[model samples]
Target: MQTRMIDKQWSEKYPGVGKGPVATEPCISPEYFERERELIFRRHWLNVGRVDEIPTAGKYFVRELEVCKVSVLVVRGNDDQVRAFHNVCPHRGNTLVLNERGTCPGRFGCGFHSWAFTPEGKLAFVPDEENFFDLDKSQYGLSAINCEVWEGFIFINLAPMPKQSLREFLGGVATQLDNSPFSEMKLLKTYKVEENANWKTGLDAQNELYHLPFQHRYTIGDSFLLKDGKYCRFSNVNLYNYHSVWSCEYNPAHKPLPTEALLNRMDSALTNIRFDKRISDFDWYLIFPNMALLLFTGPSGDFFMTYNFWPLSVDRCLWEMRYHFPPAENVGQRLAQEWTIGQLRDTLMEDAFQHEKIQKGLASRACSHMVMQDEEITIRHFHEVLECEMAKV
Candidate 1:
């Protein structure tokens, strides 16, 4: 159960990360969660989906963000521009765009009162035009939110104006992963789980590898084969503006499971597209607030995954992990991709099953603050960034 000696001096390595006990109140208090909703979730750039989801004009999707307490309808205008608006009917405040996603043929209609609208948020038709006076068709339309895109990912901000652009928010993480073949891969599998735990608590677990060798012992522990079948050591940690990145060293001599063997054979066949990252390293990026971009090896060099943690309340959050891969041309490649999905699902269940217990423990007030190890520097850095953003609220 020993890990190879990596740099244990996290404070010394990243002196700015600071040494402090992360208070338990932030994780279990409704008031603090409210502040987070106002400051972080509302103002910060949030990645809702990919551009490919709405490739054609008039294609739209509704994202129900419980944290922000608003349903956002993201649509592609006739000009091929993407935008977001509050998914509410202007006349009666009825929920607009009930379906999760679809193409509206450049127009949308409110089923509640038969109010029609364009993809550009313009009123196209009204059921009772003569009934209501001063019903300016131009004025009564879906209120728009600040929307932007970065590297094909659609992002939205509920704030009247976001403090920083998506590029600024991404900063170093973007530079590090700029060469990453994210666009070459498409979503292959998606796992969504709602758990009874503070969003921060679940995020803390994901932001570090401290628990991987232990908590995922049976599911992924054997796969890692770290020294005595335990311990995960990060090669390096880099903190960027409002974000962080870590590198995981893949042990070349490590033993692979049966499925991995098949994955390897299929992977070796696709030698045309070789990325250094896919060979033996995992570059994990933690975007501020609640996005994790992890690029690692799959059956091919074009594989990656994203973990999005959306807060619903002080004691609950929705966790989603999406696996992305290049289009498979052979059955072996397809099976390998499916095997990876199954493995991730099993591993996440082990993680989800413990969230409620953590929330309950924090709520009990058994401890005022929790300790952080050098190996878990990212968790500490995450709290520091969160506190800074919350201060602005």
Candidate 2:
């Protein structure tokens, strides 16, 4: 089959820099979805699960690559190492694990042929051993895949040998995470939303702040400043990858905390804390290809939150928002943090619901392409990176 090349006129007009309206068809086309499964998800360093999920030995989690029709069993081995394996039996191809997450009893046995394997992918036992006279149990171990953990997040590359290691794939983004508070935080709460939009569409909506005023009017626009929100900006208007880092400062001049609200939430230490008058900001790190880490800091301490967008189908995505907070000893502090999380949850729901409607509108035949302006540079860069990656394959 002849691959349709990107038009020469389009390339010439954009010249040196590829800037053009991305066609809406890519979001709804089945062929593009197949290409993404092979070129993007299968070849890239995709986030599988968090290390906290498999903190102890024998702890395991199952992650499904629905597009590729594969399931992976990620386990923390007795040797204090993490490993991932094709969650299938060697005897017949039945999945070894059915549950989403659990603690394996040091060994996994397939129900079909009773083929047993150790946590480290070593074949341990086989029922009716004598019946298989020439069969070698040692050679029939569970198939293993490439897996690594970075900053407490487990990443899996489905390719037999990934072109780049996870660290190399992340590049400078990993350094930014080191300075953030993710390593020292505790899980607060997680909210999962299933949206009827392509993963890129949902991610594009979150990557830029341009739509905050119009789309997030009541939820965040009331408190967020349109022009002065961002700080510590990093922009890479490249073809294959793009990233941006910025900070949003909370408004101090708006109004002092109400007496009752302060008394209910503030601790003695927090009340006495002196904040840098100019530094009441939250830092946002968007690593292109697919991940977002948000760090919020004040004089007291900090918290980290992660947003992972997983593509389920061409027009369906599973968005996970996980929050991490500083460890709290007092009950009041914990409750106050939970209240803050509740406010964020409500705000995010408003944002995600609006994106679903946007997806429906994009699917309409009336809209052929998306128009991006200068203020939406992040969204433009995202489309450029995606098109470049797709072109390579």
Candidate 3:
């Protein structure tokens, strides 16, 4: 047998993360989900999008936060400030922006009564102003939400007064990942799928690498460093106060496909792109509640991706996947980027399929809790954090 220094390395490093099976009630219980929706999602800094999305003035987008039952409109005003407002007209309680996302006019006009609001969320006009009994537009601006930006990611808090600021809530996550080169990359591809599974179920599935070699065998089975030449193991792991991060080295012996070989010869393939921020070949961060930030080393340059699991119901969630990469300069580089995107896209599709089946299994109640190993410490720690947060009065 291959000699090893320590078994259960993660738990040994982080002793508070107990070694035990975690209850599945958080994944399948409707009552628990409601508590999570109020105590966890609404109170935390939920990442909505990136500042790059609204690069220019008058650009805006709308997001329907199903978990909190609110529609949010994120906009960039002419003053070059980004802001978010409730996507509802104050006049008749109608939706202010019907489109999913687009550039705003001088003012957003309500379809119901033609009430208009400026990009800054100020009420600009109301049709037949003189006909109103004593209407004051100053007091009728769009309802604003708590919005903040960190490392190019925009997060919104639904709490009337958040327990902590975005930076404070991020805790060590902010300090470790602060000043990352996220602004260097550009948006590449986006995919959204409405999965019939609890948000945590999907998030838990992606937070560990124990399933990488098994569930992703056909896609990225040998992509990570393995132990005893059979199982994957993390190169580094850090469990923060409210968030966690795990990183693993890429397998050096694995052979690339023919296409990848050709692409590498033409341009830098998905080889390591050295950066000061990268801790390993791959870094996966669970940004608490429902967002994941991933940084990957590519040959040409480094790239990043984000995963947002938005809860639709206790048993349903919307999974959003987005990729950002360095701008390709040549045709070969473009082709290589496309291949990289396709490779990851396929892998995530497999994950989406498995999430539903896992939900089904959890619904069956055959097992009340999920057994954990040293490799799956992140998932266990996540449930612990979930329980701790949900328990808050």
Considering every candidate listed, which one attains the maximal lDDT?
3
What Cα-based lDDT does every candidate model obtain?
Answer: 0.81, 0.70, 0.88
* RMSD (CA, Å), each prediction: 2.6, 7.4, 2.3
Worst 10 residues of 2 by lDDT: 231-240
Error of 3 at 81 (Å): 1.0
lDDT of 2: 0.70
By TM-score, how accurate is candidate 2? 0.85
Residue-pair clashes per prediction, in order, are: 0, 1, 1
Give the RMSD in angstroms, all C-alphas superposed, for model 1. 2.6
The digit string of per-residue lDDT tens for model 3 on 86-183 reads 99999889988999989997899999989999999999998889998889899999999999989889999999999889999898888888888888
Model 2, position 296, has a per-residue lDDT of 68
Show the colliding residue pairs in model 3. Answer: 271-299
What TM-score number comes out for model 3? 0.96
| Highest TM-score scorer | 3
**Tens-digit per-residue lDDT, 199-270, candidate 2:** 887887887655666666555553443334331122212222345554454544333336425634563234
User: Could you give the candidate ranking by TM-score, starting with the highest?
Assistant: 3, 1, 2
Greater lDDT among 1 and 2 belongs to: 1
Off by over 4 Å in 1: 1-4, 225-229, 268-280
What is the C-alpha local distance difference test score of candidate 3?
0.88
